[model samples]
Target: MAGPNAPWHQKKNHPVRRHFPFVLLFALLGLSALASAPAAALEFELGAGPVDEIDGDGTWIATASWLTGQRHPWELAVGMIGARTQAQGVDTGDVYFVSVSRRLTWKRWFVQGGIAFTDSDNEVLSNHWQFRTGLGYDFGRFSLSVAHLSNANTGGRNRGETFALLQVAF
Candidate 1:
């Protein structure tokens, strides 16, 4: 007997269980087809992850934006973000950002670099400015990004941070 949500191994032992790779391949192809045929210009995303070294140790973030220039070389986005730590008594901040990036496409791979400004909401930690750049790849419907953020004031005590993001745009 197995629970409703049990893993396949716990539910049954069968030869069909070995066909996962083929199932995944077909699913990916279906998603790619859907992604390439788009009907809207606005996209929304929400994600949560752990942020190392912060008292809030675990960070949860959300983003919403309007994207234009569909699949073009030059792209622009305007959005707001709420990033907070999960630790007790830690200050969580919400900021607004506007970014512009150019897509460099090579085969199925692409790289994008962008600059953004954040309106710091936490007075103690806010210098009101941060810069970001990302490297990504487009697999029809999915894009993976590795990005970094640095404070504008080098003379100040603010430390820079980096984030690795994997995005699915549909």
Candidate 2:
């Protein structure tokens, strides 16, 4: 019978697995549109890096942020664009995370922290909530930084995801 037990069915197949790419595209487009608006001092950044595991093996990570620009040395941003990982023959599935963060800047250097709400509880993100933090240096339209995400021991496997990201600001 062509049912759940069929050869074409896989145990790891999430109901939404086939729609991930489309989801990613719409996210990117939405962020880009926000950045394209004529609002003054609006800022947008796109970043990618590696997702590290305790075993020293890692996965690729991508992220993006949209903020209200620099004002009074502090700003608020919506940081999102989820990530996925495959470890030990286990697919962590898609991670849908969104956070409202406070970005503080001093001269060309900046530090940010925020609380994130996530949709997946997997190897990398084992909780319904996560904390996001980053430190970086801005160079005109570009920046370099490291981003760290953790569950603060609220769930299983507190192993955090930390990576170096090169950001393009527009």
Candidate 3:
């Protein structure tokens, strides 16, 4: 006699399902903020490199960021990043994250720090808080950065990761 309305069918049974609404709300707010921004105020950056691993098996990394606007020395951005590698006997181990960053710049040079919420398919890692920091050079339309990412020891296993990336903004 169970149907779609059955208690077992309810989203509360699943942990992530229970939080879906909140995640959706946060995403909507972020999108609305971006939509209200000036048409020419968006800056985009894309970069890729390798992630260092404790076992000497590196992962391929890539990231994209959108800089919305600036306030004095601080620039605000939202970013998505991913890394992939092999673990065990399977081609596994991947991590993805969404983050917000604040950058302080001095003419052609800049430093940034950000917090990220992360998800990983790797059994050795868990969904956790991630911190990122980097320094880069801005050459007008193009830039280069060397960044580090870690769980700040908040997670039981935090080996950390690093990447050198190139960026372009319009």
TM-score of each: 0.53, 0.66, 0.70
Superior candidate under TM-score, 1 versus 3: 3
Which ten-residue region of model 1 has the weakest summed lDDT? Answer: 44-53
lDDT of 3 by residue, 56-142 (tens): 556667666666666423233344344444444323345666665667888878899876555442333444456778898888888
List where candidate 2 sits over 4 angstroms from the true fold. 1-38, 72-86
lDDT winner among the candidates? 2
- Judged by TM-score relative to the true structure, which candidate is superior, 1 or 2? 2
Off by over 4 Å in 3: 1-36, 71-92, 121-125
Task: Report lDDT (CA) for all predictions.
Answer: 0.49, 0.62, 0.61
Which RMSD values do the candidates have, in order? Answer: 16.1, 6.7, 5.4
lDDT of 1 by residue, 1-170 (tens): 87867775575642224444544453354334335545364444332322334654444333433334346454444444445555555554555554455557777676666555454525223444455565766665556656555565543545444555555554
* Total clashing pairs for each candidate: 1, 0, 0
| Highest-scoring model, TM-score | 3
